[model samples]
Target: MMKKTISLLLMLCVIRSFSQDTTQQIMPGRQNAIHQQDKPYVILISADGFRSDFAKKYQAKNLIALGEQGVVADYMQPSFPSLTFPNHYTIVTGLYPAHHGLVDNSFYDRKRQQTYGMQDKKMVADPYWYGGTPLWVLAEQQQMIAASFYWVASEAPIQQLPPTYHYFYNEKISIDQRIETVKEWLALPRDKRPHFISFYFPEVDHAAHSFGPDSKETAEAVQFVDESIGKLQKVAAASGLPVNFVFVADHGMAKVDQQNTIPYPTIDTALFTINSGSAVLQLYAKDKNSILPFYENLKKNAVDYDVYLKSTMPASLHYSTDDDRYNRIGDIILLARLPKVFNRGGRPTGPGKHGFDPHYPDMRASFQAWGPAFKKGLQIQGFENIHVYPLIAEILGLQYDATKIDGKLETLKKIINTK
Candidate 1:
């Protein structure tokens, strides 16, 4: 009896481990349509917190070489309040953060009367919180197979469909193993292969957040991503398919005044609920009548930051009341000026942070693409990240209603080789 009990406990441990790290979540009974088998392949890669100048600054040889072989943009401008989840989802959906409903990394939804946070696993995977048609969803709706190693909203069933091939977000898998899986996907039969794939790397972002962006640790992390991309490209080339690569970053990083962090302003709990971040803060008023009084008081005493109501926000940001399609933008918003951030918990703040105004030079993102379909040795001017969606859709011959999306095909059409 003792021996049997011990065996049962070991088996239970194995089951729990498998449940936590289920590497692949595939939607069976799905295959690429016959016409899609001949379509071009695009592997969209996002290296988090990889600043616009990181490649040249860190001497990322592989990415530099890839840019020379194909097309390179001066920089990619992320949407306003450039947080990770919002900008990433914007890139895939071709909508501004406000229009797509992911207003911030963590935000309150008035309709649900609930908070959506990046750390909340249930909220992260819940489809109801996400809006806009993600690239994977768009492809699958058209009968094309799509895969994702990991991308924001990829695990969620947006439009009642997740990617045909995807994985729950986890860090346990080695980079080598992940690359091997991509190779395996490409090697599958024509109908079973995925034409559009998304891959993400979080090492640079992690290192930069813990250590300053200029720290040696952050530099090493950049090199790691550079080397990993080099390996992925080499393995992908061996697949004998006309695979295209679009390398991008969600947003850049900046060093802040960690020693002199700003503490959250005092407010009555009964009147308002607060969602705060290092770079931005939002106050949701429980009573609409109480908003102006608090806004006026905060504005009078505000320091090292700027405050704005949804109706009064700068139009250039595309993040005002008119843009808040899902009503997730706070009743009152606060944005910290550069070199300073808010610390609501009074904890030691990290030196490196993002979620700043996108117009700042440090907030710019990186964009590079190389493949058979692109014009070789061409360098282009900087453009908004939203334009990327239409570019990818055009290359893959995927149809989308241009009227609904903010991206315009003409913005990036010049980069592709039509002849």
Candidate 2:
């Protein structure tokens, strides 16, 4: 009995020592590992309304060359309505239309009962006006900086710091001038360089809206944006600060058949307004109750459009929630499945029109990335706008809340050499 007790005590002591050592080994700092990784400077470029087919159809040598040097997605499916403001916001926030609070290009706030559009800079620029944290805000928080040539939320005063620098909306400005301004910023000293940068070209989207998607004008505009990307890349190279450019579009477009086109019913006092996308229509009603009748009427009557409440919106849209900061989406959402016109501003005299349909091939946007951090000759499956947000955050080496976002940075793991 004495020998057994001694053995037991020895074993107990050994076990206690092992446990203590293990406990010390895994103390707080052990689990609190800081993953410090080398990050790359990121530049995001948007060719408004440019579609995936443009890559195969148009001879965009610069874009194609960029793809050859990096990765190209089969398509970058946009969020709901595949419209401009919402989709662009999605790209930066990594959330669906509903979550990001930019449900559409134009929407009516039920609380304030006010209409909103990109042109409404005062409201749009308010950080409180948005829901998710854009990469710019994330970069600022991480002590890294960001810049923008002409992006939707770039000019907005968000958090304590917005983009380190940005150009307010200037419709009359030329795309080249925008590129030049970006170049000037890129020339800043290495320590002063922004970790992330974004540029938007609305010319192609404008041209597509003015002249149908198939028009020679639209094709020419694609080439123009491609050349613009080329020039920007050249400037970055000249600056000796290698930059990776991620080229994307807010949404794609499809030509509306005149015979098939149906105009939306005119409202009396305009209970709601709309923000046009390549194929989505985000409607906002002044009275939430009015939305039900309006939505039911569209579904029962307008068989051409796919309508849903913001809550009922499809998960695939990457915009499947309502944001407190941006809850202005109409009670009933109307998405045109067929190529048609909503004609909010009275039959826009344009050969082209978006804000209609997405599932269709013509409505799928494009994506391309090239630079030191990108893999050459790589191709990826088409993804959503939200994916770009995480990828941008990853490239800039900034931490972000992926939980709030519908996107993930793992999407770029194959393209970037983390090892």
Candidate 3:
């Protein structure tokens, strides 16, 4: 009994050590410069895997109401190979995944001889893995205060600068508590309050992956997010700040064929290293001389997928060798057809998946904006997600080098209320 008790205690200690941290992290001695004290507030919220049509299909009443008060896009086009980390980073940096160096959720960087996966906390937090000046980094560079409740790469001190007020990503904090924290930030003194804040929700993505995008569980998760946003808005209003809210999703979820999953194509392991995804697979050649032969073989045997050399990828994707600034993209790319996904080693797979080409309707993501800075009762055509960085930057009056980022402010400038 004593031995068992000691083992249980040890397990409890381990769990505590690894458990999510709910503490608010703040950078000391930081304040909004006097010039930024009067700037408008922008709260950027991302609901991962929230599809463009989910509000209407799942009857997200609160979101519908919010849309009626602001601008709604028909859909938001995610960058190529739509995935969470890549798209989220793309939205903030206004650069495509390849240009931003996040190329995929899981990718091997030949230069660093390192692999970056979303689940690897150390890799995810390493600033070396990221590129491009994120909006928060831009804001802080200009002495504007920024904060993040949760966002991709928010924990990383990119450019050696993190948001003035932030929290490490964790789900242990209840929705109410999260909203309350936002309220607290807004209630801070003029110079200490963050003018730009980012918030994120992972519930919808989690449910969709586990129970399929159309399942009741996914709908429930959507509703929860919808209600949570409503609460956040109410609290912000109570703070009496003109908070502009921009809601988006990294990518949409698709109900995929869980049974009879696609098998990994046979490859000579000696010559290649593989990074596999549900809808995409990348093979890095050990020798440049071996690439063409292996690629030709894969192309000939490719079934239910399309294979391409890095240079031959469609120009629209902006993911070809010309766009691979960091050399993070694989030498050979394999894109899985819809409803089919690669399941290596016959591992258990989820019913819902993404990371497909963004051109597919099922891969389009959500976008909505409301509050004082937006034109009311407006609906617009779909735009690429990169434009979002400029939108938020414009709203907060944050200056950025237009030449350094891909987003053009003109793409979203018309939606801002000039009057």
Per-candidate RMSD, Å: 4.4, 17.9, 4.1
Report the lDDT tens digits of candidate 2 across residue range 150-233. Answer: 788766677756777766655656667777777777775655556688888887888887788878888898888888888988
Instruction: Give the TM-score (vs. native) of candidate 1.
Output: 0.95
lDDT of each: 0.91, 0.71, 0.92
Clashes of 3: 0
TM-score of each candidate?
Answer: 0.95, 0.82, 0.95
Better of 2 and 3 by TM-score: 3
Q: Give me the displacement of residue 244 in model 1, in angstroms.
A: 0.3
Model 1 whole-model lDDT (C-alpha atoms): 0.91
Model 2 gets an lDDT of: 0.71
- For residues 257-358, write the lDDT of model 1, one tens digit per residue: 998888998888899999969888999999999999989998999999999998999998899999999999999999999989999768998889999898
C-alpha RMSD (angstroms) for model 1? 4.4
- Candidate with the larger lDDT of 1 and 2: 1
Candidate 3 has an lDDT of 0.92
